[model samples]
Target: MIHQGRLKEDSLMVMKIVGDAICANENQLRRYLSKRQSASKTSSTLKSLRKYGFVERHKSHLAFEEDDEISYKPPAPFTLGIGGYKLMNHLYPEHSFTQPEQWSKNSLAIQRYVAMNEMRCLSVEAGVLRGWSWNPYIGGSAKYRSPLAVAKLESPQGEIQLLMERPQMAQNFIGYYRTKLEVYRYLYERDKYFKIDGFSKANLQIVCLYVSSSSMAKFIQEEIRLHTFPFDIWLLSNEWISEEKGMSEAFCTVNQDGLKRIRIPFLAPKQM
Candidate 1:
């Protein structure tokens, strides 16, 4: 049985943040708490939340790098626990909740989500509130299929929608890569009438931001160019994401005509 004592203000804040982001690891969650907050303190807060059945910690190994016959490396990531979902559902009735079935998907899925969220965060820093966040299960049906998300932006003359796609490991599986491209090809052809998010189809644009290392980014870029599919392509690196540069500088857009750069709409005033 749980007492349901008064929830601490910070705990509620953390729960909402995790809910908004879908999931966050310990360090990521702590960054929202305070830069000066120690790991032990954050752990304690998580412990309390877990004990109260408000959040659960998921153990994840995001990678397995083999440096030698005896040495291996792995990443530790977290997802919401059962209690966390309960709390999240209570707070955000507009959203549905589900725990990640396995970490294998996180290698690309979670990182993609994190990068998208980071971009949104930067937009928030610029004071823009109009956008959408999506889950892996985005879109209404299999035929329509979903990209990472659809961000609605207001340009100087009109509104535009930006579709986001982050390829997890495009080089290893040619079929998977082609399949995604084919889907995009389909969307590109019919975007003018594809009604998503209550807005007209003519305003939507797709941007596939590469989050992997430079080598992978290059490989993915070449793969897309080989197909010559029409859409905005960009390479989002850790260095660029860390700075306050507008989307134009942060993302190097690629096209057949050559690379083009454009400022991302809805950036904070300061960023503008």
Candidate 2:
């Protein structure tokens, strides 16, 4: 007798992480998986999950081999397929799973998130960040505007709210860029308050950490510098995932003061 409960628990943690991040690649999965497990076992388990239609992969392929006959190369990212969504509905009925259709359209967005999760995993290993919080407003109405994602990283210094965004890169880049800057400027200069939940406000150091193509990053940096925006913002390139140096080298932030490189233990995380 195959117990569905047991099957669900077999890779429950993996599902939670995938569902939370919207998607993740195998490399990111290994960080949260049990270190004692062998690589072969991990690959086999993932294969079985795919066979059962619990998870589906994105079009992009990673540069690695998974000891599987199904494909010569493994997929880059994986998300909850129809079956996986059903499992989630069974586990948490309070949440709705009626709209799995939208997940496919957001593949590019998921790619950016997968990269951010990789950075999150690295931060955990470096002992700089204890944990992070994914914005809870997803798939729901937001009372106020919010970042594409908000990661609250807790460190000994203090907590820092990393506003994650992957804005569209189009020919009329300036138009899109100005809209985002204006929104942040309003949040910074006008509101002067931070609210995570309905009630209560805790003023914390908020920094915009955007991930985009190198060309876009350069243009955005120039825009911020040329205009001399008063709010604090950071520009991260897609190459951030392949960076061999520390986080310090991976990003640069701009403000009225000037442009500067940013690292973890990010400049006293007190209320700004």
Candidate 3:
């Protein structure tokens, strides 16, 4: 347990990771922490941190309880506590830290946050995650839409600037996606006009869509077939990503030439 009004090295690292992601669950935090540490040890650390007001744990309702495939529920997610926010502010004065309000009240938004944290963990394990940000703005002017998350991945070929979106299943999601596609296309055409740190039109290689089921994946894929996008649009299912294999599993995309299957480049996980 933390004492002496001070945090240990591991505790500080945990707070930083949670602060960076805005919100992450216990399992996700364990995956990102040192592999040498046992699960029990990680849990102990979190308990201590919470006790000392370094982190806050938020319980999540079973938003996907209607889905028959899910046999178990996930754990509550964590956010920076008052102490953690102060530490982060001291560590990186330029970076702003805002506590997410009503994070658990909106089911869809919470699900998306959890999914993004999962992806972030995968990237960290693969050792290719150069940088990551949540809800990043993606256009030239102030009137720009933010993707769910943005990540910069390093590979043998080059750096890949990726924009990720996970739209909840809805009646008019197809139209929403088409409009999003058009905005991305517009940014791609006028790449020179806009510039954001670690993101650019030339380097934006993949726009990944994380859906909930195979049917939704197929529905989105069919809609994607109607348009020609400058960047690759990959469709992934939540079930597949939650499996033991994780991102190692292959995902499919639809282009002018029809459907094509592909894996993330340099996706080998670090040996434990």
- What's the TM-score of each model vs. the native? 0.69, 0.74, 0.82
lDDT of 2 by residue, 1-272 (tens): 12665674556656655666566777667655645355565556666777777777766532211131233345467777788788887887875442356656654455556767766665654545644555534212375455655665655556666666654322244665566567666655665644443223334555554554445566566665623655456776545534344354567666555456556433222221
Sort every candidate by TM-score, greatest first.
3, 2, 1
What C-alpha lDDT, on a 0 to 100 scale, does residue 87 get in candidate 3?
85
Candidate 2, residue 168: Cα displacement in angstroms equals: 5.1
Comparing 1 with 3 on lDDT, the higher-scoring candidate is 3
Ranking by lDDT: 3, 2, 1
Which regions in candidate 3 have their CA more than 4 angstroms from the true location?
62-72, 100-108, 168-172, 192-194, 200-204, 224-227, 242-244, 256-258
Error of 2 at 66 (Å): 32
lDDT of 2: 0.56
Candidate 3 pairs with clashing backbones: none
Off by over 4 Å in 2: 1-8, 34-39, 61-75, 94-99, 130-143, 168-174, 198-203, 212-216, 238-246, 255-258, 263-272
Highest TM-score: which candidate? 3
Error of 3 at 20 (Å): 0.9
lDDT of 1 by residue, 1-272 (tens): 22476676766766676666665666556654554456677667777877866665654333311121332222233456667777777777887665545444444555445556665555555554366656333333456566656666665556656666655422343455557667766765665333454445555455555444444455555665632766544555433444445443455566665444345544423522
Show model 1 residue runs off by greater than 4 Å.
1-6, 26-47, 51-53, 58-78, 90-93, 100-108, 136-142, 154-158, 169-177, 191-194, 198-204, 244-248, 257-272
Which candidate gets the maximum lDDT versus the true structure?
Answer: 3
lDDT values, one for every candidate: 0.55, 0.56, 0.70
Better candidate by TM-score, 1 or 3 = 3
